[model samples]
Target: MSKQVVFHIGGWSSCGFYSKASNVLASLSILFPSRLKVVDHKYGSRDEYRSWLIGTSGSGFRDTFGISKASNQTSSPFAWIESSDGGNSFVGGCDDTLAWCKDFCAPKEEGGEEKAVHVDDGHTKGHGYDYDLVVIGGGSGGMAASKEAAKFGAKVAVLDFVKPSPAGSTWGLGGTCVNVGCIPKKLMHNAALIGEILSSDTEPFGFTAPQALEKGHSWEKMREAVQNHIRGLNFNYRVTLREKEVTYLNKLGKFVDAHTLSLTDKKGKVSQITSSRFIIATGGRPSPLNCEGGELAISSDDIFSLEQNPGKTLCVGASYIALECAGFLAGIGVDTEVAVRSILLRGFDREIADKIGAHMEDHGVKFRKGVVPAKLEKNGEGKIEVTFSDGTKDVYDTVFAAIGRSADTGKLGVENINLKVNERNGKIPTKFEQTSVPNVYAIGDVMEGCPELTPVAIQAGRHLARRLFDGSTTPMDYKNICTTVFTPMEFGTVGYNEEDAKEKFGCGSYEVYHSSFNPLEWSLSEHRGKHPAFAKVIVNKDTDAVLGIHYLGPHAGEVTQGFGVAMKKGVTYNDLLDTVGIHPTSAEVLTDLTVSKSSGKSADAKGC
Candidate 1:
């Protein structure tokens, strides 16, 4: 409650807008010494401010205020409000900033002294329930919603419990990204990349690796470090909840009724609690392999914390999980193979997925096509003996099942309230995450048809909280959701794929502009694999509207993010050409795309 609010005001020196905005903000900061402070950044020009922001806070600052280096319009200074709680809310450009500061100080500046962000006492009352908001599953979405609701003075409780995997793997809060999915996966993926650099990438750069490379990777050490980092994050989330005054219970919650939930601890002790509203964000677990001796294979839940190096790994399935695991395993000097019964990265752009598969093949990863694991059993040597559907068998020290993920709604007692769950994926069907029961909602992977992404879930949760507590009507936009598959050569994509675009716009309605280029970073490496990285943009010919953007190369996630914002704003193909590109970067290839896939012309890069 004693936390100070900071206004980071960025502007050009000597500009009238900056002077006026500074005066308004200065008045507020001076009046409310304990509550408000202004950090003034004056630059020689608008571009100087842009350069300063980028140099100071990098992408985070640029993204917060939508500071475009490309923008030439010097309309007004940009301002953002940062609370001591580390919550950031944009206050907008000069005009909006002055208006907001005026509103805050007007009450005291005129006659009445009032709090800046005063929440009505009516918003805090629990309406006769034990809590105002009871969030089940202490994952990212639930954590965010609970904390935001608490900001509105609403009482919130978050219950989270990790049921041990079949292999007994369990972790604390922050959900899949922190515990098992993105965090650990990226750590291992980067480790594999480093291993590749040490083994070969160093030669071209005229450097030798440490002698440890000769002995190969130590999976035990990597596992230890990654798990330790994850644990720290988990602890921090717990502390964060405490600091926000949001009650957190390390217990599993099941619906006792529409308004009540049964909390059961690991010891099987049970208690009942009630809330005026509930949000389900239990997330998902890796699906079981579902075959004879399938339990013998480990899931992603066990891979991160594995006690021993997974030697000669056979990753079964074609999901990103499967390919990523295989990529890292092979990169670290372990023999790795992926078994596929169908296409790779289903629901993603198939061309990009096939390219990823080929890139993996060019590396050390092998593929066993047209075969699913029919059986998994221990051989005489105590290794996993995997029998394929084709009756072929292979033995391995470990087997990983990355078939898919199933939502954790089965045990939540959704049936008790007649909440409909998509029987196929066990995901709840919701209208903007609201279930059939008006009081209950769902987010994250558990929501039917929702993008199964952590950030999406987090945004949905925070936006839902604003709607519920602050009376906002902004719905979560699900279109053009950007995603990346972190294989050896990562694939980042947003909007529709080629096939999907064709399906939506008819075959002749849309045009595909694609290019293949060797990233300058890879040009020096002699071992730059078989295929050059690729980029493609699908545009509607009728309106020149950019329908989709896809890229495969290094740091694909970083490259796709800015394009995602553009896609959200309905950026057109002509818009891409009009934008100047930062040269020699992989992202620039997108802006320079000229070859049409329909033209039957070579999409390969023209000579430099």
Candidate 2:
């Protein structure tokens, strides 16, 4: 009685014991062989499925369309047709199947041409929401997820706003990585590296003594160049959203309820909006120093864009942020010092962390152990007078509080929705990025236990959007992620550190293969390359699989990125030995790892 019918995804029946919808269609097909149509689900045309009946039971529609009930979205792909207003007659649900057949047999003038109305899903106009998805924070994760959902023909919006730091430092749209975090940090690190290279006595490399660098480098000039590049990235993120047709809201959002958000613009304007789904990628901010006159200190948030030179600076913290800043400051001849309350790089491999500390120390970054700044105040010379926890005192032109960062979820109103957040760090706990509330999700540093890295956030966000909209079954893999610490020596690591490996595999279960090699790049250079590069590989003794890899050398980021890819295959120590090595590369050390730390023989290399 109809032209044709297709079931793209058959719904479940008898608790998934049988494909009930497929049986229903088959029985009907026998009665009307010429009128009914059925095709393999794989062969189903992409565009034609929109008009076809998505055969499903009450709960079946959810699986049929890959829409989870927790999302609270209509459990049908043709939901727009069912909700269409002031339109032609519509048929929905399995009960209406026979009724539609009867209508298809009737005359055209009688309004029975088997016609189906077409509607766009790009905007949830007819659906019950101001937007399909609203993302809080315009950082790497939020922006990546928003653009991906929009690409799948879903309406998406991103909301972001920056609160000025204690020192009145503010930035643009691309969030921490592009603004004050990775981008600026890397640029400044490179600038310091270049200065170190130029000021070096490079007689072996055929470079003459450089008298031009006799005048110390200009911190203002480098800061300006870094800021200019960051500003461009910020503008590009905004333009990307516009090009993708995703709404860009320069407002801060707080939850009013499960689906409602109270939005506040920069000018103190307030409004309310609703969305079917929410993804929080708010990230974190530098914690303010909590001591007397602590406000006098700047943080990584303000250091990249500092107006004046940070002369004779004291970096107060042992975290990577503190070390990186200290490294660069010392490299550029700023006479930098570091004050530590505890161990450096607390969560990293202890051995690697110790080497980095020693390397920085040799490079002129002073360290004051077991002490934190108890008080910071301006002295008569305008330098900050800092009182240590040990009752000692010091003076410095600038004090940088690289203490740590806190997730910016305090005012996010997650409590209103009963979303349990990590009270100490403000990180939201999630399963596959899904929060306690079904329709809400969390990604990036804001999510509890996820790596607080930009690339990790971007990968998680993109994967999350695919699962939400593209019927993808892939979940974000949080394990074995490669990361780097941009200290002066540069440390790159992936998978478990040695301590964690021992804890996971137990003593005598995992053996450590390590080497201390002098790179050809540094073998003859006495001016810059003072420290020999180190490498370590943690292997499961039983399985021979590489449990972890760590590298300390130049371009650690570049060397580690390839390991990240090879790691996906579960590469074993034998597999590494089976492959040939690339000559004179820092990464090749991983493939040639033969000296076990347990052997007690020195892991040092004499030749390249």
Candidate 3:
């Protein structure tokens, strides 16, 4: 029996028809026999083509292709090819066309056999998995990956569950940054800044009111406002997932096998899903010190939601979290003290860290350096009595522990699949986010050696999705990432620090150009001598390329972000010098930097 084949070349614009139709027709001829009766229908526009393809144009070939009519001959099958009239003529007749098409469509994986090689949606004609991608942990990374995959027509699902903190603090959909970490921290930091402005800067700025002269900040009001904003963000994330057609479940996922997961919800209801691929982005949580009465001390997770103001607070550890909490506490008129086990910002440059510490000290925040908390005990007056390893003790109304964070990988069932994680820290080790198990991948803070930042995770996640669904091979670049510490004076940095550059390239291999300048906005304030803004540019002595950049001043984050782009482009000190300086701005210090460390000249800035 002869088969009816229809080639409807419709909607091909002038340019597209010439470029694509010849190759497509070549593939079609190779797949079918010459006995087939082939009919070609050409149309100029997409609307006209759609009408004919749907049989509204009264094209008889639509009936042959089984559009509205059925064929009595079960043995004969029909096929359709849609195209447009391009200027190019048909290149070959039947046999030559068949041979060329066969070779072109041959599977590269197998030896010249035509097989479906799916690239976009993870499904290949015949597959057994229920979903194309299943992402565990609906944090920033997981959500990004899920949404990106869905955009390519893949069936994606995300499972997320937030286990409460030790202090019973819990949050919703948008993960740590939105629920507890960055969002709340920045809001509280801004609140403290507002308090400082009202108490100190308002008078200098020529704005003053009787009520604005009050010394205290309303902790209750600030907490409520921040929490309300966080709640709205959480809801928006849910709405986004729904709009993207990515299934979101409030369930905890545990690996049952390479392609299977057992999901358990809050009420103990359990379900299972199987996918061709999986992503783990569970992220991390704050860790408390292991000491007596340590449970009494709260971590950052609980601080933002505190019911009342933390008065006379003692922050333990030298991590950025500790310094930030101490800075804001002091800024808000609270008596804040920091207890450091060793150096501040351990992996950061000592010079910059010391400057930050000195600035904090000048701002009324005290530091008890070189002391580790040996024990903590409650005093009779409901204060925390902390004992140091050096046999000294002090009391404070509240103690905050910001020692470090641990990745949330304990309950992920990595052991079931022999997925290796760091023995010391529960961080999943992966190469390009692919775990030891072929189908399993990891991203975000849970991955070993990955940066514990939100944007880093989001970028990695989106990149991974593109690699899987869009046939992209570019990996996430982790170098020269700019980060900001929201201390009272703020610290923003990109690329390597001075010490790191020296260690990597040998001492005296680089030249450091630095300046101490007063931000124009600070002219009216008392921060001139005590908290002068500083900028440092580290350049390779041999190449003259800018290796690193650091800034300390108001809105340091805003200033450093621009320099970060320049550093990524390998902007050199000469390039910076050639760039025009924006007058009266702290960031322009980079362009105007003149004093080198070797010069031994004073780097302090004078009046404009």
Candidate 4:
């Protein structure tokens, strides 16, 4: 007698996985060797099948056929585990079944099975390295990429340098963002911003104290505390990585072949690993300015370790980093001067960036616009003389070089592989985190597209994990990615800029809505100037659809995130109107704008 097997392509909500299984079964028939008949569940009603899978949300698959449980049976709360290998193996049902039974799984003594697997798109690929996945640079992208692939039953291994950062004695499993780069920097930025608020706002608000606000906090102590928090997170990340059963190599990894890697530990020991797929997320480092006497300048990495603040500082570059450092110095009563070759913060909203420059100047930051640093020379008096392209020179105590960062792909043997890196800016070329080689992927600053923000890196890493390991083949859409700067008053933006929209869609087709106001928090302050918040929306005049949203204010980053989500979901101006505003909140200003009623421009008088 031929054995008959029925394939049920029910609405299991596994996103067509059951249909995929049916296709797999059809393919398996030719290879099964044994004679078997397959039945389709076409005749069963959808309601009946759903009821079968979720009868009580408890015992969804109790022996409806009156079969008794074996004396030595392992009981799992899943709907059923109908293994092709019979009672020798067990496979849990759909995600709903797992969710239903998750909390009820019994103790080890009662012979209960382990918790059912989630089987999301992130776990589509089977675990292990015999499978096609290879993850390079065990930072955020690498760890997440490898772990997700491993969960999908794909063989995954991460090659990363476990070399400790000078910022901390040890490294975390999550990589740069969590360990040394963004996370630590952001924490310091937060602390510094608070210090600025106390200094700039407290006295004006009639909140006097015996001690000066600047003396109320120590930058060194804050740095140590922030470092401690980062170290703790690193430890927790290691524990989580171990629980996920990921293969982590404590060595420097480089591309050896299209699907192979060479890992070298600090001890000069080397090991080789191969995989069918690979990912490159090594990220980037601060670029060297290469000016004469450049060694006298300090990069962003040294800022956290500064034992004493520079009494007078000249910051080079109009980049966000440079502006930020200048702002911090100005806040702390330093004679700060920011010099830029041309426009400050190129690629940023020109008007807003200029206004910010004006604000900086108002707060005592001198702007040396359209000036090039020819060279730097340290005099005997411990003052640094910086000469400009026009043969002019002035002296300051310190110089900060904040030009930009470059992709860290060159030394990683990426050139040896099939990967084609773009020569324009020397970044690994990728289409939505995919590299030249099909198996190898790239994300973060190591590759290009979108702003080089930590959140962008995390998103790319997480999304790649879902697509490769969880069976989600969806590509990440970069549209409406929110971004911010941690300067005095935070700036946040999402979607197209006014110029970008006009360039892409023409100015006649769009309208702008903008507003600036002093926040309620500053009501009691003697500095009655507007709190320096602006909300601008670019919209298609015909459809009333919001093309972009830009905000400058406190918590701008957090507020813009929700707007980013709305833009991603294709939310329109009418949608904005329909949603009830959260009263007395800074975000409500986004909804309060009436484009047709006013000039749709900020009222604050422009000054520089």
Instruction: Give Cα distance to truth, residue 576, candidate 2, Å.
Output: 1.2
Among all windows of 10 consecutive residues in model 1, the one with the lowest summed lDDT is 107-116
**Which scores greater on lDDT, model 1 or model 2?**
1
lDDT of each: 0.84, 0.79, 0.78, 0.66
Q: How good is model 1 by TM-score?
A: 0.79
Instruction: Tell me the tens digit of each residue's lDDT in model 3 across 1-608.
Output: 33334343323334354225544554466665462223444466555554544456455444444434322211111223322332222223234333444443322222222322223334453468988899988888889999999998889999999998887988899788887788888888887777777767777878774484464577888889988998898899999999999999999999888778999999999999989889998998888778888888899888988889988899998988899989888888789999988899987767889999998898889999898788999989999899988999989888999999998888988888888888788898877778777678888999998988898999999988987788777777777889999988899999889888988779988999999888887778885467687889988885577888999888988998999898766687888999998987888898988899899999998877
The segments of candidate 4 whose C-alpha lies over 4 angstroms from its true place after superposition are 1-132, 162-173, 203-206, 210-217, 381-383, 528-531, 595-608
- What would the per-residue lDDT of candidate 4 be over residues 1-608, giving only the tens digit for each residue? 33434322333333354445444444545544363233433214445554554465534533442223422222221223244655322233344333322222211112122221222212223434454666777677667667766676666566667543333344556666776566766676676566666765777667774375636556567667876887788677667667777766777888777756787888999888766667787776666667788777776756655666666888888888888777766765678898888887787676677767777787778888788788898999988888987788999887878888777776677678757876656688776577667666787778876467776766777778777656565665555678887666778888778778879778687877777766666545655363467787887775566888888877888899999998876666777878888866778878866644146444542321
Which candidate gets the maximum TM-score versus the true structure? 1
Candidate 1 residue spans exceeding 4 A from truth: 1-126
Considering only N, C-alpha and C atoms within 3 Å, which residue pairs clash in candidate 3?
A: 8-81, 8-82, 9-83
Which sections of candidate 2 miss by over 4 Å?
A: 1-126, 527-530
Q: Model 3 Cα RMSD, Å?
A: 16.2
* lDDT, model 1: 0.84
In model 3, which regions exceed 4 Å deviation? 1-125
Query: How high a TM-score does candidate 4 get?
Result: 0.73
Q: Write the per-residue lDDT of candidate 2 for residues 55-105, one digit (tens) a residue.
A: 233443334444333234322222212212333222334444433443333
Tens-place lDDT digits, model 1, residues 1-608: 34577788878887888888988788778878887899997788867776665544455355544545423333557677765566666666778886676445421112112222212223335379899999998888889999998998888999999999999999988888889899899999999889877887786887877797878789888988998999999999999999999999989899988888998999999999989889999999999998899999899999989999988899999988899889988888889999999899988999989899988998889899999988888878899988899999989999999999999988998888888888898988877668878788888888988888889999999988887788776777777889999898999999999888878768898899999888888888877846899999998785577889999999999999999999877687988999899987999988888899889999889755
**How well does candidate 4 score on lDDT at residue 101?**
27
